[model samples]
Target chain A: MGAEHTHGLHLPGQSTVHRLPAHLKIVSTLAFVLLVVATPREATWPYAVHLAALMLVARTARVPAAYLATRLVVEVPFVVFAVVLPFVATGPRISVLGLSVSEPGLVAAWALLAKGTLGVLAALLLAATTEPRDLLTGLTRLRLPRQLVEIMGFMVRYVEVVTGDLRRMSIALASRGFDARSPRQWPVLATCLGALFVRSYERGERVHLAMLSRGYAGSLPVLDAAPLRVGDLVVAAALPTMAAVGMGAAVLTR
Target chain B: MHVPDGFLDLPTSLATAAVAASAVALSLRGARRELDDRAAPLAGLVATFVFAAQMINFPVAAGTSGHLIGGALAAVLVGPWTATLCLTVVLLVQGLLFADGGLSALGTNITLMGVVGVWTGYAVFRLALAVLPRRIGSVPLAAGIGGFASVPMAALTFAGLFMVGGTAPLDAGSLVAAMASVHTLIGVGEGVLTALVVGSVVAVRPDLVHGARRIRAASIQAAAPAPSSGHRA
Candidate 1:
């Protein structure tokens, strides 16, 4: 989704949302998700408020609404899970559109659907705004620990290479009359994965030897600074505050 | 089996996050000792490989598809501690950039997929190696079983969390049975890949494998004694 959206959906807009610190964006996104999750399902009004606030942020961020929606298609499976919830959940029954549904189940379904969709959008907006490298740097600065961060930096860098390897292996298998759809062809599929793994392990060995030849101590050198400016705090505070209000209102009314 | 955010309740999410964070803390200390400059970059590449491996979903059954969790495979290829860090990186990247998982649910994903997946799988793989007859084939066989078992173990952990914290009224039996059934099938793919990979690497460079580290050392020692006996006679 990130790759596709980067090329087609992400618009180059001159907006404050785009300029906000990546760490702040990450922090606030978490805060907002907590607020949404804390909000009770019994209270629909608060959720409505939360949704409205998200739209305002989207507008502020200058993310194309269509693009946001397209990116959000990743949440489609959860929607399926939600659609089935009413049928499976045992609760008081009600009728909607001349069909029987569980009352509590409907609420549960709504809760899952709304919160899941909003959470995914929060992420999409973050990605649509920040570059992948900047996000890794931000995570590193967020005190996520150096070992993890360095690994993430390299993982992001080499994902394309590893994926290319998988593609090549799959093509090789296909050329050798390996039809994956047949149940009898499990051995061929297994061999493809086996070959891929051996190649990957060898690659890991060579990469290790290469890194060692360079002056790599236990940790990667920390060079860039991730300063949390006052502006970042201000931007980070806004969404959470709104989310808190949304949750409080849900609790009070319920 | 990435569980998206909000599928789990707050308590479950928070608890899992705490566990994940602590495990990461421990792993960081361990990695500092295990990773010299050379291994660190390779660990990064392995993580990237896991990420790409995940994207290539091998078909499981008629229409269902599953991706590589790569926890056990990573642990077997790299050390377990390094593998934990690698899997953590993969999860973070997937969560933040790809939006494949919920940002809020990052801890839960890491705990189940990274820590539990790597440790449990690696432990089982090691145990199998210990109990089995010392043979090169057994190394991959044990790794295969370990990789297969780890997926359902992760699923079981999720089931436990949901049983406690889930707002949905799913019965424990139905949920576990459903999750186990699907994951057991997924495990087959995991085992095959892990065994084949670990086996091949052992064939080429056994010294590089952390799980096979002891086994390789033992084999080398045994071979050295035989050659020396021939020279002495």
Candidate 2:
């Protein structure tokens, strides 16, 4: 599970998008998503424009189109749900391939699907570019409370260890002739989970004790400096500006 | 449970963010007290474990798959304060680094799955524990009920948000019913996993389980030989 983080998903490129400040990008991501949400279902062209703009941004950012497609597939559930809306939606019926589907419903479904996919893609692009450590720094700089950030740092560091613990427990259970396929083995699995919790608890206690011994007050020391430069501001401004314009136009039209 | 962006309307998303940020703030204050030197790394481990466990999706219906929310499990194992912080980290990393959740919808996701799910599940678990037999084994029952209940609650929250910003043709009543129905089955998987995890922990390091700590201690006290006449029983 930990190894999944190092997969081929993140391709290093010296692109401008990859160099932007995480905090600004995060703000932009929010604004962009709001713009997508604000776009009316009736105005198909606005959404199309939004999609085209996103593609252009991705292209400029040097995000591989193939990667975007792969990522979009993960939103398939929402897509399926959107597809069903046309049939179930209460509106005037229209014939398509010898079946009746509501015109408004079809339009609504298309909007939902398109908006959801675009939002997901924008988020994916952000994640693809930013490193987790730097993102934490940016959050702390943005006045996200120090304590929360510290806890997040620990979680990022220890998530792998916990996963390893689970994997080992499962393997040990398997070795003991406990097959999870049958109902009878469920008790064993339950027992294993309980054991895992206890281990994690003990680990927490030990960690706490160690921290106490080291003169740890409530807050942790900030790991690195986060200097929000002029460049960061400029890069960050671009996305939000686009989002504000797009969303504002959509709202005005509606 | 990992809601991507654009699922909810702006107002709902913003409101949820405010609620979630407050919850995170309160939890941070409490968690700071809990996180001595040793617990910091353990917090990380807990988050990672959750991430891994979530990947192992259990089939709800034939084709549909649902994964553990892990909020109740985290809260019961660690204290609710620490559990909330742990979940917040997992969600943040998943959203920011792994692209598992949407960046913009982080607030709503944390509100539903982190704060609401854990507190609701843990509260029910504590109540159930009070009514059930005073035994270490009873933690699983509490966990199962907690897990079962939280999923629908989160789904309902999602439905509420959807109603506010929905672009689709879904009616509130039908959406709620459909969401609750699908998530009810998902809750079965959640219940089984949470119970199993809680039960196993109670077996070995009962002191580690925040929810079961009292029962374990009581059981230990009960097992001890009757105190001398001068000694307190």
Candidate 3:
């Protein structure tokens, strides 16, 4: 097993959704998720509307349903959480298949699943449409600290390198007849990790030297990307604007 | 242990976001002072290393297995400030690309894992090292103390936050107890592995271990030009 996998999250397209500035998409995504988080669990209709609106964006962006299915695997823990809620919750008991479950717990479980799923889909959609570099570019213009953003950029670049080193080390261990079938073998693994750290740190020192030789003067070249336009703002605002409306109607009606 | 979106209420989530944002701000300043020109690429590689390290799995029982959490380990390898940044970067990338934790929940995850975990682990490492002999051998034991405490502290903090803003009406006390006890076991694994890694590194290259710095300075007559310093002028 290696650290290799398809790192390509940004689905390239000529659609307007793909053309929208990264910063605006980031703002819109955050705004949408915030609205979902704020809505009361009883306001279930808003959540359905949120999903419908998300599906519309996904359609426009041409996000593959299969890719999203893989992305939503993050929901498994929440599902397990929802499963236990009914049993642990205290409320009026309702019998189903000869087993009593709390009524309040059932409602709570539905609330968690609905809100959690909507929030995740909204984020995944953002990832699907935006290039990772543009996402960082968006973060930079949003006034995230320059140094932190720079570090994040490096992480994006070098994650594969370090993980590949790890895979090779693990393979080396296996080839030497070391089987990590139990925790007793973790010390050997830990030793390997120690070695890996030394290698990574040395590589970092070499990179520092490389940067210095290239005249890195304590900062990266300033990123001056202001790609958003008035029309793009309206396009970006559409999702959150609808989310805000859904939130208002949810509050008033529910 | 990434908390999903719906678990925490908005007010609680916002509060944590503010807290995480401030801590990151502080860390950016601290890391600049610590790493300076090297902050960008160096911290990036450290973040990548932590990401890679967390993937290593160790079997616990007949079937169960667990992976490294790396906060305490990172604190020992680098300082707490850089370690905090490393974790934030890892968590942010994971959230943006994989949706591993919901964006709305990012603040809470950063607070629990980065700020609370690194600070507590670093503090415990310092305190544990203080009581032991002033030698590199004591480094790993101190790291173990840090690793042991960091996990439960983060878990305890999460339990506290849940009590304040949990969406569900689950009993707060039970949640706290469960979170603390389960993490204590995980912390045991964390502490042991931390000790092992730290010990191994100290044996060969004490200078690489941040927590072993005092001992390295005391034991060596000169900066010794660390055989692996990569030619610092």
TM-score, model 1 to reference: 0.89
- Please identify model 2 stretches exceeding 4 Å from their true place: A1-9, A167-185, A188-192, A199-216, A223-226, B32-39, B59-65, B223-233
Q: Which digits, one per residue and each the tens of the lDDT, describe model 1 over residues B1-233?
A: 56777888888889889998998888877876665555456777777767766665556678766567889988877778888888888888777877877877889999998988898899999899889988766888899888998999998888898888876766589889988997888888888867766776677666666777777668767888655554422
TM-score of chain A of 1: 0.88
Native-to-model Cα distance after best TM-score fit, residue A177 in candidate 3, in Å: 3.0
Top candidate on TM-score is 3
Model 1 Cα lDDT, one tens digit per residue, A129-152: 887776766787788877678777
Stretch of 10 with least lDDT, candidate 1 chain B: B224-233
Q: Estimate each model's TM-score.
A: 0.89, 0.88, 0.94
- Model 1: pairs clashing at backbone N, Cα or C within 3 Å: A212-B38
DockQ of each: 0.48, 0.50, 0.64
Global lDDT for candidate 2?
0.73
Q: Would you list the rank order by DockQ, best first?
A: 3, 2, 1
**Candidate 3 lDDT over residue span A7-67, tens digit each:** 6366788778888988899889889998988887785788888888888888888888887
Task: Give the top-scoring candidate (DockQ).
Answer: 3
By lDDT rank, best first, the candidates go 3, 1, 2
Off by over 4 Å in 1: A1-13, A95-101, A175-178, A183-215, A224-228, B226-233
Positional deviation of residue B218's Cα in model 1 after best superposition, in angstroms = 2.1
